[model samples]
Target chain A: MNTTIRILRYGDYDAMQKAGSNIPATNSSNHATSTAPEWPLWEVFVRSKQGLDHKHVGSLHAADAAMAIENARDVYTRRQEGVSIWVVESKYIHASNPDEADSFYEPASDKVYRHPTFYDLPEAIKHM
Target chain B: MSYQPTVSQLIHLADNALILGHRLSEWCGHGPALEQDIALSNIALDYVGAARNWYQLAANQINSLQDKAAFPLNAQGEATEDTLAYLRDAFDFKNFLLLELPNGDWAVTTLRLLLSASYQQLLLQQLSTNEHADVAAIAAKSLKEVTYHVRWSEDWVKRLGDGTDESHQRLQAAYHELWPYIGEFWENKLALPIDIASMQAQWLAKINQVFEASHLPQGVLPTWHQTGGTEGIHTEHLGYILAEMQFLQRAYPNAEW
Candidate 1:
């Protein structure tokens, strides 16, 4: 027996490059000699309280994961807005390609049968 | 010991917290990284919060003892927390000299905080068990905050000490520069639950643990340790700190936010 796994890639880097986007090249060496280059960006998620799902708050730059979480706490949770925090490297986060948005997501809008709202239910079934 | 700490002793403790908090706040927007900038500022806020508690307690203590001949009154004939913080001169401040030293570099700041936080952790731990109810309560509250401060500084100490040759050297230099002031923290004669010898031993053990983990040298404390901060003697740095911190209050007396 053989097993198969599906892998999806997001953000067309080649197309983005061809379009001459403003995104900085990954390994540029044209920085000033006096100061070190900025650290990588991290996306921050915060859970406002226990039993709540983590929601995307904002992003910050940090040297590493540990620093990223700490930075998230300082920047996002300082106002007691979060009881928990999550940080992901912006580089590691594969965002959906904006150029392919219509092809990828537009078809789902036409699939009206997938909605549970179409089901005929008794008058007492309020939640369904 | 059935000893009760004097209002002066409480004032001294408050002074230490306020001065250190002010120093840490200096790095609010100037931290090497944005994360670090926030972290340091958060720590500064905690210090200020703790100081407010102590100063309030001290002020209450002073007010209660106002009828006593030993208590002295200010020009306005009151000893409020604000008066203690803003109206006091350099010679009257009881903070340790270690805290007043300028924020030299990241390494120096981290090491200094590590040392101060370790001592404060032990001090507050002992105070939390004090016979006095108010002292015990304040210490109990501060202990929670100081515990994180210790961990944060300890992590930075380890990171900088074992990070690289340049970082290691910078940390070592910080340790040397800060070692002398460590003695002043221990020399306080306050009538608290703290055993100077025991606190010293515990502080040294904690420092040694970090040093071992950081692969830094140990047993470098000077034979002749600097003292006199508790006696109201301080370095020139305290003058500058007070000048900036107390400026608004001094300029606009009785000004309310």
Candidate 2:
């Protein structure tokens, strides 16, 4: 009777606790207290300099866009990991739904020209 | 090799690092990020270690002032915990004014850390090869750590200062608030608290280049209303700090874990 399933959108989850190994805490709610309830998870990307693509760094807590930027700089750039940063809220992100994955990504499999396999390569077009 | 450092001088020497380190540690786990928390804490630990060395040295002087014979430092007979415990108390510390202020923000801490590392690197580099083995050993180890801390601070200072409007504002504010304290580093008797006029100038020259690269304005002396920290005077914050830090050591004299 239940043949269908529900799938969550992108940025639905985050890896929050990479905290130190077994560091004792007198209060269990310290981390939770600081993190906002609707505080969107942010995906971090670090670019070492200008005109560069941002590589995924790590996640951190932030209330808004401004705080997000500041938090990213403090967390990822301490080692000068990036000259620029990109923070997209986890909730704002829209990834290909898992239920739609087959239709979304696998449709390209039938399009051979997209893979460059169908193109007839002349001897002069060596690299292509 | 050994050197002659007065008990008062040794206390101040350790005071600079201990107090600054103590202030920096307040950012622990509360830094804008986890990595920053770890990095700042590491620097704090380094200063704490350095302070312990100087305290041990200072304690030796206390031993010498006694009427007892052949007593080890921190082990003088007829000496209550009050003697050594006093040094651990914040009220007794003589750190420079530059170290006692609030940490401001990431940009400010970066600026302060950068300034500290540059001064520390140069001073410690010279000290590592000095005639005093204890000082030299501490300097040698500290120099390695300060080198990276300086690089990290310098790099971020440039990025945050030149970035978008918000970051620029954060950095500029941090700069103005912190710039006044820069002069304390160049003054001979504040930090080194000794004769080092030449070294101060040399450090300034090296530091000037990095500050320029960060696009920060040149350093200036503190405002007329604010310049007592170098000479044993302190802000009201210093006492609170002493109360917390010395609590354990004072409450239980000679207690070592």
Candidate 3:
């Protein structure tokens, strides 16, 4: 039941291999003994008291999820803006490549028919 | 009958909160991490807020009594929270010895908070049902804040105690240092609203449970129990705390923000 969390840098394959492939460090504060590794970054989302969904507040560093939530509470909810919080490890979030934006999204920009604006409206469609 | 006991009880509670809040506030910008730094400050503010409430109540109680000759007063000739807090010397303060001790490290601070918050939770719960309306209301309001303090400290104690060998050792060391002073919480020198001794068993049980969860040692007793902080006899540490905390007020008498 070792609780020592290890952070692996993506490019440091040699060090990762040397440390035995993502296992928990045998000792807590292992980072302290060597070069100090920063705590993992967690993206914080806060549902404001009046909001229906959690909104991205900001990111903070924390050792784990529980710590992340507490950190988020302290950092994001200091003004009582939040009714709830959600935290996800920053590394887990995936985003579309900005470099491929033209090929990925430009094709839909001129396609007016895709927006349903070209369709004729019914006479009884009052809400629309 | 003199309202001496009620005033003393209120002052004792206020002193504990003020001293410990000041201690926690010392970690404002210097915590191990940014998030934790803000967290500690938030908790410190809570304690200070509670201290103000208790001090105001104490001041009111003292003013209601006949012995106005000894207490400090403002221009309007009424005792105030500021006067009680800033004017009193270390010998007049009745805070627990455990609180006035230096915040050694993150482990020590969190562990101490856990222990004190647990005791306060129980004490406040009992006081919330007290005969006095003011006492009950203050206790009820303070209890909510102390509950979160307990949770935050408990989580840290578990993490530090169970996380690494070094962390565990540090926590163990803090436990050894702080254990002796815990006896003063149950000391019955004051005519408090409730039986202080009666809360000891529950407090111990809670401590033992947390210790077990944290992978810390349980059943280890201190060689000797420290006492007398409740009776105005304090450790040398309190004088320094007062000197720093009351410096502005003491230097500039009747200073107003």
Residues A1-128, candidate 1, lDDT per residue (tens digit)? 99764332476666666889554444322221212236789999999988889999999887688878877877898889999999999989988899999999999998988998776899887634
Instruction: Write one digit per residue (lDDT tens) for candidate 2, span A33-94.
Output: 43244466788889998877889887866666655776676567767688888898877777
RMSD of each: 10.5, 13.0, 7.4
Candidate 3 off by > 4 Å: A1-37, A105-128, B1-5, B195-198, B220-223
Each candidate's TM vs. the true structure?
0.83, 0.60, 0.84
Winner by TM-score between candidate 2 and candidate 1: 1
Q: Which stretches of candidate 1 lie over 4 Å from their true place?
A: A1-36, A117-128, B1-3, B67-76
The DockQ leader among the candidates is 3
Per residue, candidate 3 scores C-alpha lDDT tens digits across B2-90 of 22337888999999999999999999878777788899999999999999999999998888878775888877888999989998998
| I-RMSD for candidate 2 | 5.7
DockQ for every model, please: 0.27, 0.08, 0.32
Candidate 1 at B165: error in angstroms? 2.5
Q: How well is candidate 3 docked (DockQ)?
A: 0.32
Candidate 1 chain A lDDT trough over 10 residues, lowest sum: A27-36
lDDT per residue for candidate 1 within B68-106, as digits (tens), equals 334434567767778788888898887888999998888
Order of quality (lDDT): 3, 1, 2
lDDT of 2: 0.68
Q: In terms of TM-score, how similar is model 1 to the real structure? A: 0.83
Candidate 1 at residue A20, lDDT? 91
